[model samples]
Target: MNIGILSDIHIDREHPEPNRVIEGLVNVIEQRGVAIMIIAGDIANDYERTLHTLHLIEELTEIRCLFVPGNHDIWNEKHPDKTSWEIYEALKAFSGNLVNGPVALPNGWTVIGDIGWYDYSFGSSQYPIEQFDQMEIDDRVWQDKIKTDWGKSTIEMHRYFFGKLETQLSAHRSRKIILVTHVLPLSDFTVQRPNRMWRYLNAFLGSKQYGELALKYSVAYSISGHVHDRLQQQCQKTVFICNCLNYASQWIENDDPVSEIARAFKTIEI
Candidate 1:
């Protein structure tokens, strides 16, 4: 079965709503006979935007759209107000299939993945953070919170994320499996944007550790998005497609003109 993958639309409340792209996307999916549409992450600029965009996405098509969250989804500066779990819950409520692990799809295919966070660096491997860019840790005390928080603590969170993946994968080993994420697993597709900060974020968001794990477990394909520039690459046997916005829109006022950006979404056979 064919699946159309997209990400980082970053639709804000301005200019073109997702309506235009959603309509075009629906037409393309129908024309291509794709069975599913996977929106990896960054479907909107924020939480409220995600709610609006998902409603638009659902209205424009009958195809199932599985979603995930990106760094921006939880990058809000407020702690008690914008915790990662809060953002996750928003996503879960908006998209019934916001996959944090493996889920069975139509036909014999199995899907797994997360709109995962950057694997924050530890020790000597860490990226330099500017003094002005201090983390937003508000009144939330780390010591007081434990199992309830997902990204507040150690690699234990990642262990849980990956652990769920391993379990779901183990249950369905024979089907064609597709992994979807918001961040690219390798450096090749990630180097497109000039922002070093975003590049660093992309590098650590989704674990390269899990990328290899998926390959080891016999995944057929892995799709991702985060950096706006479009690209494609491969790791061992798995194909990685960094399919960014199907079309650039005006909400990104400083981005390339809409016509130029829209050209990138031209269809490709799977």
Candidate 2:
């Protein structure tokens, strides 16, 4: 079976013609003969658009689609009455293929995933907790802190999801597991020796605990996207993949968004 993987589409941040971009992506997946497609997250910052995007993909393509929510996807800006967890619950109901639990594929692979929020573990030791807490001092105030209300600290939410992931991993111990998350799982995947700005921001990228869990469970393949840079690497028994079509502002010279989507949405045969 062939499975396609892509993430961080960020339709809200993309060019004006998002539907066209989606159509282009669908064509690429169809041409590749992909049976299933996994979108790691950040479909849109707006909840309704996220649902609309998923519905659009399902409506336009024959390939089965699976997804997990990104931090941006759960932002409660417009809906002040709802918490991040509440927003996640609503998203789960809307996303028929939300892979928070175990999903057995036709090819005998078990897929498991969650939003996988981060802890400050990825931050450099040079910086202290106070710095991360007071994000404005270093100009690192991410909108996630203000928009998302999980009713728990970042580390607490990370632990909560980690426990759920462990349960899924243990249940599917005998099968080849494909784990997915919206945030980076390993510090090794961070930009090599990041500058001062990136170093500080890395705190919100991901938690090393997720990588440790992947290793502990011996996952066959792990997928994630938050960082716009596309990368893949092998860590022991697991191959980690991050494929993202970030905002046009982040694109390098001569990089077309549609073409980049075609190049980044890799089809893996299992």
Candidate 3:
């Protein structure tokens, strides 16, 4: 089986006619001979559009599509009345969402996923934890600070996901695990810049504990997004992958939507 993986499509950030984005995805999936599509995160900024696009991809390609919610995916910007948790539940309600539970695959390989929150472990040591908590740097606020109201500190949220994911990993410890998350688990996947602004931004990018968990549970593939960088590294038994089809302006290799998506689209044989 070919498992197609990619993250941070950010459809709303690029295509004016959303159908074009959906069509591009379908075309790529077909061309790649993907048996199952696993989107790591950030399909779109709004939950509704995100869900709609996932549905369209599954509908058009006729393949099982699974995904975790990125920070942007659960944003309440368009629907201010809904809390981030509400948006989360809404996205998880979809049958294809991996957030619901682990999906068992053939030959003892199982996949588990979640929108793991950042724990400020990725931040620069120069900044205090207090500063990371502020969720602002250089007078610019991290968008999650504005768009999401989880009603909990970032640490609390990270702990919640950590515990939940640990339980899932423990249950399937004997199987070949493929762990997916919206946030980067390893610093190797983070921005390589040593500048202050990036360091501050890096604080919210991800957590080292996730990488720790992958090793603890002996995960075969630790896949994630939100860093907007395409990086892959092998540490111990796990292969960390971040294949983000970032903002259109950030695209350097390709200009066409289908080509961009195709270029970032990665596959693993199961």
Predictions: Cα RMSD each: 5.9, 1.6, 1.1
Encode model 3's per-residue lDDT on 161-217: one tens digit a residue. 999999999999999999999998998777886587888888899899999999999
Best by TM-score: 3
TM-score of each: 0.72, 0.95, 0.97
Give the higher-TM-score candidate: 2 or 3.
Answer: 3
Indicate the residue-level lDDT of 247 in model 2. Answer: 81
The collision pairs in model 3 are none
Give lDDT tens digits, candidate 2, residues 85-135.
788888875544454467788757888999898888887788888777665
**Which tens-of-lDDT digit does each residue in 46-108 have in candidate 1?**
666676777666666666777777656544442456666776766677653556456677668
> In order, what lDDT does every prediction score?
0.59, 0.82, 0.89
* CA lDDT, candidate 1, residue 266: 30
CA deviation > 4 Å runs, candidate 1: 13-18, 75-82, 120-151, 154-156, 192-205, 246-262, 266-270
Q: Where is model 2 more than 4 Å wrong at Cα?
A: 254-256
